[model samples]
Target: MIVSSFFPGRIRLRNEVFKDAEIYAALYAAVGNHPAVKKIERNERTGSVLLEYIPEKLPINKLLALQSDLLALGKLAEFYSAKNKPEILKKIKEIESKL
Candidate 1:
């Protein structure tokens, strides 16, 4: 994730994973529901997310970490699904090929 822009109470971030709408939506939902956040917007086309929040209530890093963890947990869940075992191997090979 890259902090495209940031100031006092607002921040914009861009991540390649966010180009996948489903992943972006998941993060959007998770962060948008937070009490400290006033607004959240995402543009999947550009993989950009903007957040308006109460800086006093929660540090921005914690919000970013929360989104990252949620995304990881969601992906990890897919790996453990019995129906996805075959898919897990396929994905592993895909990663190995990159290495």
Candidate 2:
């Protein structure tokens, strides 16, 4: 994952895995739902994740760590994709699109 931009209360990340809706959805469920996160936006076409958070509640270090973890999971997802069942992968993508 690459940090595309960072401002007072917002940060944008770019990652190839963001194009995979299933992985993106898991990222949302995990980090986007954090109490300190005010909003999260993912653009699959652009492979970008934009996050808005309450700076006072969530420190930059914590957010960075979360992003690092998410990126690591993305790598794992890529590995599993090569070996997982195709039907399961399709189902995950379908469910992710709904969110």
Candidate 3:
């Protein structure tokens, strides 16, 4: 995943492809509700996520960590199988707890 500052209050995440639309949908469901996030725009063609957020409400460090964790989850999804579903879900829960 590639993460960079896009604007004063925006961040761009690039190259985040998943195995399929289902995994992509799951990723959004997991991270789209961050309290500090003002808006989220996903580019399906390029597998990128653009985030606009309130710095005061959510520190940059926290946002970065959250995005990093989400990216990791997405990568894991690429190799998802019935045997690993439970482990993946547990990890997702762990990441969510931090948020």
Candidate 4:
């Protein structure tokens, strides 16, 4: 058995994840105090927004799709900026390799 001291880890939020989170948070915030959506708590300890009330049965397929769309936005932003085009292409290639 593989024994380790590591507790369950959280999914690391890359820029793409943060972008998606920001979009989702903004959308939910606009609907403010809705039964299906709520502002994540601002945690003083980590200075991060904590989403603590997601229903256990909520499916994450849509969330994953949103994240993919946000990653595309990041690539688009890189393309429009002065950054190298190859870099964005390389990143997208890497993502494609994973799929």
- lDDT of each model, Cα atoms only? 0.61, 0.66, 0.67, 0.38
Q: Of the candidates shown, which would achieve the greatest lDDT relative to the real structure?
A: 3
Q: Which candidate is the best by TM-score?
A: 2
Clashes in model 3: which pairs? none
* Model 3 lDDT per residue over 26-61, tens place: 556666787777887788877677878788887767
Model 3 has how many clashing residue pairs? 0
List the candidates' TM-scores in order. Answer: 0.56, 0.65, 0.61, 0.32
Off by over 4 Å in 4: 1-34, 44-46, 70-99
C-alpha RMSD by candidate, in order: 10.1, 6.5, 3.8, 10.5
Better of 2 and 4 by TM-score: 2
Give the CA lDDT, 0 to 100, for residue 9 in model 1.
79
User: Candidate 2 lDDT, tens digit per residue, 1-99?
Assistant: 577899868989886667877766766775665678899998888889998989887776665655544455445445455454344345444433432
Candidate 3 Cα misplacement greater than 4 A, ranges? 4-8, 16-19, 64-93
Task: Give one clash count per candidate, in the order shown.
Answer: 0, 0, 0, 0
Judge candidate 2 at residue 29 and give its lDDT: 74
Q: Is candidate 1 or candidate 3 better by lDDT?
A: 3
**Residue 18 displacement (Å), model 2:** 0.5
What order do you get sorting by TM-score, best first? Answer: 2, 3, 1, 4
Q: What is candidate 4's lDDT per residue for 1-99, written digit by digit as tens?
A: 011121122122223322334433542353334343333443334323334334432235534644664466466533443354445444445443332
